[model samples]
Target: MKAALWYGKKDIRVEEIEEPKVIKGNVKIKVKWCGICGSDLHEYLGGPIFIPVGQPHPLTGNVAPVVLGHEFSGEVVEIGEGVTNIKVGDRVTVEPIVACGKCPACKEGKYNLCSLLGFHGLCGSGGGFAEYTVFAEDYVHKIPDSMSYEQAALIEPIAVAIHSIRMANFNTGDTAIVLGSGPIGLATIKCLKAAGASLVIVLQRKSIRQEYAKRAGADHVLDPNEVNIAEEVKKLTGGLGVNTAFETTGAKIGFDIGIDSLKYGGTMVITSIWEGEMNFNPNVLVFSEKKIVGTLAYRHEFPATIAQMSDGRIKSDGYITKKIALDDIVEEGFGTLTGPEKKKHVKILVTPDKSLLSD
Candidate 1:
């Protein structure tokens, strides 16, 4: 079997590797498609951040220089002992987060905050970049026959969006302003709309992304370079601002813009993972009674997102911009996804199994 291995900055290699064996209470999946995520790009550019220099993962205990990929879906090739819910030949998507159920956070039903929580790709456990990945049965969710593998690969990210929206707790008919037009931002738009948001205003700089956001169901798409986002949002809401704002660009300017676009007493959810701190005005938040909330990786939304995709409530086709074989993972997939062509690329799904790639 062949897998994409990460060593250090800009070092990704596709090499032959031993296939994983099914273990007790674990299922072995033949990876069909995996999406290149923003976090993966971050690690590729300058990392060993999540995977420390010489120390192993606190939970998984695997060291750095591991297989890299998590946003994926596959077909079960073998099932381990006592796993009765899923079986061979079943299509599935993994939730990725393997948490210690005994932790205080887990006990409180907040598994995302588990003290010993770890994920496959980031922690060195063989991940979806490989031909086959083995995982505990509890992390797998069955995908309906109606859902395509590319779409199934996206459930992980969609679940992230769903979780962020769930954190906001927006009421039906609340207006939302999303400060980015990347895959997650577009997914946020879809999630907000499905959550019954009356209007969604998307702020983006790139024309391609702005067009893509509108196609993904944003009520209004504005280019921040062309117009003042806060003023436009205020005009849209008749001098008031959006009830909810999502900051997904991970840019300091985007954060400021999102904050300025929020109505008094409104909620702002920071969904992007920023590596460094940025300056924000404390007085504005204090005076307006506005709240800023942060959302981490998802908890318990995979199956729900898959169900939504199967029922046509959320369409993944518009976001799946490219598909390539495992052999072409580095150049055609990762390169195009992170390079100057990023705006043109949304979700690039890589398939270890070519038969399933087209399916």
Candidate 2:
């Protein structure tokens, strides 16, 4: 089996390794497609953020040089002992979250907030950027037969967008402004419209990303570099600002723009896993009586997300911008996604099976 491993910052290598086997309470999957995620890019560019270097992850007990992908889907090739619900040949995608059940958050059904929070790919148990990977049965979800392998691979990120919308206080007629138009940002735009948000405004500067934002259902797209974001948002919202705002850029300026673009008493959801500190005025939230909330990974939103995509409420057709074989993952996949031409792509899916590679 060939797998991509994260050794350190900007150090992901594709090497041949022993194929993973099914174990009690888990299943082995013949991976079909896996998407390179923003978090993965963060680890590759400026990491050790979640890739545990100094010591083993408290839950998985795995450290650096771990297998590096989670946004993926595949066919169940083998089922482990004690696993009954999942059968061989079923199409599925793993939730990828590794949470400690003993935590207070988990006890209350909020596993994403568990004290010992970890991820399958980042913290390791082996990941999907390989020909075969094993997953705990409890974390895998079956997909409808109508969904394609490429779309199934995106369930994890789409789940993120759905979960964020479910966490907010917006309703059918409400409006929102999303800062940034990265993968997660674009996913958020589609989810917002599907959830019935009256206006879906996006702030993005890159020409490629702006086009994606529109395709993702954004009603209006603006570039902060060319205009005043807050002012333009106010004008669009009749000077009251939007009912809610989502900051997915993970940049300090995104925080500023998100907070400034909300109406008094409006809510703002921070969905990005930032790598650094951000400076902002506390008085802004105090004077307006507005609130800020944070969302981690998905909770009980996977089923709904799958349904939305299966029925066409949430679109995934144009999200995948490129695909490459495992052999070219570094140069054609991650390298292209993280280099100067980064904005040219929306999502890149890698296939470990060479037979599926396109010429």
Candidate that would win on lDDT: 2
lDDT for model 2, please: 0.90
Residue-wise C-alpha lDDT for candidate 2, range 1-359, written one tens digit per residue: 89999999888899988999789999999999999999999898889887888898999888888999999999999999999899999999999988888989999999999999988888978888989999889889999999999999999999998888878867998999999898999999989988899998999995888988888899999998899989999999999999989989999888889999999999999999888887778899999998899998899888898999999999897899888998888899889987888998988999988787654
Compute the lDDT for candidate 1. Answer: 0.87
Clash pairs for candidate 2: none
lDDT, candidate 1, 76-148, per-residue tens: 9999999999999999999888688998999988898888777777787789998999998989999888887
> Once superposed on the true structure, which residue ranges of model 2 sit more than 4 Å away at CA?
none
- The TM-score values for the models, in the order shown, are 0.96, 0.98
Report lDDT (Cα) of residue 62, candidate 2.
82
**Model 2 misses residue 18 by how many Å?**
1.9
Instruction: Compare the candidates by TM-score and give the number of the best one.
Output: 2
Q: Quantify all predictions' global Cα lDDT against the true fold.
A: 0.87, 0.90
C-alpha lDDT of residue 334 in model 1: 72
